[model samples]
Target chain A: MNFQPYRSPSTGRPVRAVLFDTFGTVVDWRTGVAREVAAFAAAHGHTLDADAFADHWRALYQPAMDAIRSGQRGFTKLDTLHRENLDAALRHHGINPDQFSRETLEELNKSWHRLPPWPDSVEGLAAIRRHYIVGPLSNGNTSLLLDMARDAGLPWDVIIGSDMTGTYKPLPQAYLRTAEFLDLEPGEVMLAAAHNSDLQAAREAGLATAFVARPTEHGPGQAVDLAPEGDWNLVASSIPGLADRLGA
Target chain B: MNFQPYRSPSTGRPVRAVLFDTFGTVVDWRTGVAREVAAFAAAHGHTLDADAFADHWRALYQPAMDAIRSGQRGFTKLDTLHRENLDAALRHHGINPDQFSRETLEELNKSWHRLPPWPDSVEGLAAIRRHYIVGPLSNGNTSLLLDMARDAGLPWDVIIGSDMTGTYKPLPQAYLRTAEFLDLEPGEVMLAAAHNSDLQAAREAGLATAFVARPTEHGPGQAVDLAPEGDWNLVASSIPGLADRLGA
Candidate 1:
């Protein structure tokens, strides 16, 4: 890939750090989660629509965070939130949570930790890391991100979890506080995400933004974030392409 | 080197994460800062005792952090603290801060970020990383640690900065909060340091401890932390030796 150095238009400075939104951006979470669900159902001697099951579980993600973002509840790590949603997801599938041992349920909950990265994630991140600090600015807890990085071979220079920021994405603190943690001006940091909404929030929070399209993130019926909704600083179809554009 | 797997005597669990004290432990801060001081002095046509200057600056480290630890001051990042101490050190050496430009002073203050790692730091860390997560749990702030890791080729899986914990080392939170961030029990995390006082505090906080001696850290006349003072879980002469004892 040809290299083109990236500079933030907002500050006219070369980017120093590039953070990523992990789920559905760097990793194919839907497919990975569905694969786990299929194995889980087969082991339990039950039939489940794995794809729909994965979607159903993910659907609860926002509402759970919405409660925290709205200050209706205190901040909580995504792992705990995912566990609670897992029970709800089970009941929605007409299965009782009590049927599974605590150990089994806990293992199933860890599907997020074993997610497979997109084909280009590891190589692209390794490339970008040669020139810039690379890490995940994800809603995942520190352990979840660490496990995924170890399992998926994501060559992250660092890991920034929502637990570290005490908040989730779309909140200004999540982006701004992360920049502070790195001792960087917001403009020196770029957030590359597949979701247009995440990019929009990041831009508003003073970070440079890059939109990486993941049209199949929702398994072909994806209706949102298909293209950059705002004038993102950079736009690319894949993580490798983003790295190329960044001259890494 | 013979390999021996380490298990915490307190919990009998295999260590999952190994964090180290960066200054004077993983890196020779005194030599590094002195090297930069000599260069800066030569550039400015001034003669200074570089080694004594380094020791004088370092002598102020604990007193600065103690003020914050005692709640006499709010938590501050090490960069700012280091910059403040640099001015004091300059005045103590009969040099005025006004003799240098703001940029020059700022660059000199970053000498800590460019410290040279010990011969065993990179290889030992990479070996240990194959089996466990590795990082620096130093009083250095996030940016300082990130800069040093990049410059020294330190393969950190994560960075737990003093700023991240809102406190400095020897404080219980510095040790406990780091374990909490990695979702590991204190017993599952080990702190490797050249200082027995640091290991002693970590042990009191329920963490496993390893003493890696840097007997010349304070120049050949170093008298403190020459040997393990407490019954640390593991003791080695160097980081690679520490890795051998961990069976990595």
Candidate 2:
């Protein structure tokens, strides 16, 4: 095992903690959400394109967060955002909201919490955790991240999410506040994400960045973020590959 | 195993999370602080009553928090409070401020982060965590709790502390905010504490309460809270015993 410290590109400081972008980087949300939707639709005697539904629901993620990030909407947790987006998607797809009971809607909304980890996620996280503090650095609410951690058996030393900052990713406060809460400098913490845009924002916020490609994060036809677009501190094909690069 | 749900006294709801009063309930801070102080003083070629010093330092805790609770002072994290109190204690004990370098003083202040958990703490917490969500409901700052957990191998699912709420315990906001952050009703969360005052305040805030006897939390001559004072939901001799009572 490589015991050498992983150095940051800009500051040249040894990385202390590794924070992850949860949705596409750590968990296979696309597959998990589509599978759950398929099962729910089948059980309800409804015939719908579950995959398209999952894609449409996820597409609203950024716009919902954008409203709050731009101060056009008040601060609301991601769970609430998910529920609103789900309702819109159901209406858009010609599914009557009244067809599903409140309990069923609530369960369906929790698909984010029930996301399965990527194949290498659990083992890779365990490896990196042996060397550095590991936790999510996503826009997900505290409760959602906690529930997902429990469900996926992810070993996290801490949970740092946008809920704690009242803002979403690409916002400096989200990255800066996570470092402050963890009692570390922004340069000392590295944001390991599967998306280049996340790493770009993290870099701009003065945090070290690592890119792990998730070519199918947006499903089979996913085109963007298929490879590192910028000079990230580290780039790997999978989470375990990143762990290997870090000598974890 | 009982496999029975633990019900709250007032709300009659099944408990979902067990939040601990960390300092004295799960860890023996008095002993740990005394030991570290003795070692530091000895190394610095000074003779002092380490136990008295520990007690004196702890005695300032409530007043410091009271200042914030009453709005006399703005919110400050516990680590900052510890540093300010440490400086005052140094002068009170006749230690020249110049005698110790800044690094040494800073290291000494971190003694709180290295506290030793009670003998049953690790095992008991592990057992209960298997059946319920377990974490510290502490006034200690997030960094302090994280450091202690890493140092002592305390298995915690989440770290809920005063830092998150910007207030101290026995305050309704402290208890209420924790439940809000965890996405649970107050009655679904139980405050497992060794002190009657903490449990009483939590109970009054609509949370379930569990009393565990830590007769020596204040050291050998401890007098208060040696027995359960009120009609708590569950009272046990130790954390493991509490787990058994809760059918965890």
Candidate 3:
């Protein structure tokens, strides 16, 4: 299992808590959406390209945030961003918006609130909890993440979402604000996720980082983000593997 | 198991969450401190009155904060407040500050980080969480409540401490600020606590209120607060009782 003791780069504090990124990291968004969308469309008398729709909606996610962040557009939630893409996908599929009321579209946007957790997530987190404080350091917003935790039975000691800080991750302040809220120095925290970019940002902000591989996150045609790209504090194939190294 | 529903005075929206006063409501602070002080006095070789000391400390508590709220003192955390009280208590007990190193004194103050939860707190909160968002909404800051939750296994779905609003309860602004943070209307939330005073303030601020009786909280000679004094939405003998009436 390669159970080697790792150290934080900036501070000598043994890592106390591990904060996880939710979507595509602890929760499988792609597969969860594909399955949910297929069923949702089937209930309405049609079969949709669930995977393609998922990819299309996710593709619009970053640019939509970019517009909001850059002040090119008014601030809108991820739910609104997802609905815009949903409308576009329906139009592209030759379906009228009249087919579904604004209320149904709003409810469908809540699919983000019900993503399936990664198979190793729940038990592996339970394992990790024996040693450290384990919770989400997600950008998913507070209410959405809270509903997800309740529905998925994710036992978290605390929930730290961007809504609490009014900023998104990869931004240094977002990571630092999270540590401040926990009354711990940034170096005492470890950001754990399957994304290399998030790890790079955390490392730059003086927090230890752990990388877990989830290659299928970007979908079957995904070419990039195959593995860890930086000298992360720890790397593991799955959540349980990470727990094993941490001696949980 | 009669689950009679009480409509909100303002909105009639079902209570989706119950915010708490934290310290004396969910935790048995008197018993918690009495044990800590007894252990400290025994270890250091002196007969100290931990129970009397707890009373003195809590007595000084609101006055210190009232000083801050009234602009007599600057912003200070509960940890700092406890430290000052510990210093005063040591002087009263004839313990030389120089006898203990600064590190030892600091550790003594940190005893608050490990408070004992009330007997029904954990299981009752777990049952209530099955139906609503349950968490601490105390004058204690977020870090303090979060640490207490970890130490005591308080099953909270979210945390809304005074640190977020930069104010304390008894002020209508404190209750209003919590509703603002949750994106919930005031009447959609309920303030549940063992203290009728807390429930009264919340009710005045337009939130639904539930009073859970904690008769033994103040220990022997605790005659004042054994029952609800006002007309609360739901009054129960304990947290589990409250959960049952709320349909958990």
Q: By DockQ, who's the top model here?
A: 1
- Stretches > 4 Å off in candidate 2: A1-4, B1-4
DockQ-best of 1 and 2: 1
Off by over 4 Å in 3: A1-6, A40-47, A67-99, B1-10, B67-76, B92-99
Q: Tell me the tens digit of each residue's lDDT in model 3 across B1-248.
A: 45444456555778888777777779988888778878888988988788987777677778767876776777677677777877877777777666887888887776676788889889999988877888787888777788888889888988866766667678888898778666678898898888888888898899999888888888877886688899888888888888888888
Instruction: Put down candidate 1 lDDT per residue, B211-247, tens digits, no spaces.
Output: 9999999999998999999999999998889888988
Clashing pairs in 3: none
Query: What is the C-alpha lDDT profile of model 3 across A107-179, one tens digit per residue?
Result: 7788888999889999989988877888888777777888789888888888766766666777787799888
For every candidate, give the share of true A-B contacts it also has: 0.83, 0.57, 0.60
Instruction: Mark the 10 consecutive residues where model 3 chain B has the least summed lDDT.
Output: B1-10
Q: C-alpha displacement of A144 in model 3, angstroms? A: 1.0
Over A71-177, each residue of candidate 1 has an lDDT whose tens digit, in order, gives 99999999999999999999999989999999999999999999999998898899889889999989999999999999999999888789999999999999999
Q: Return the lDDT, model 2, position A131.
A: 84
lDDT values for all models = 0.92, 0.90, 0.80
Better of 2 and 3 by TM-score: 2
- Write the residue-wise lDDT of candidate 2 on B66-103 in tens digits: 99999999989999999889988878888876788888
What is candidate 2's lDDT per residue for A148-200, written digit by digit as tens?
Answer: 99999999888865667778988899999888888889999999999888999
Docking class of 2: medium
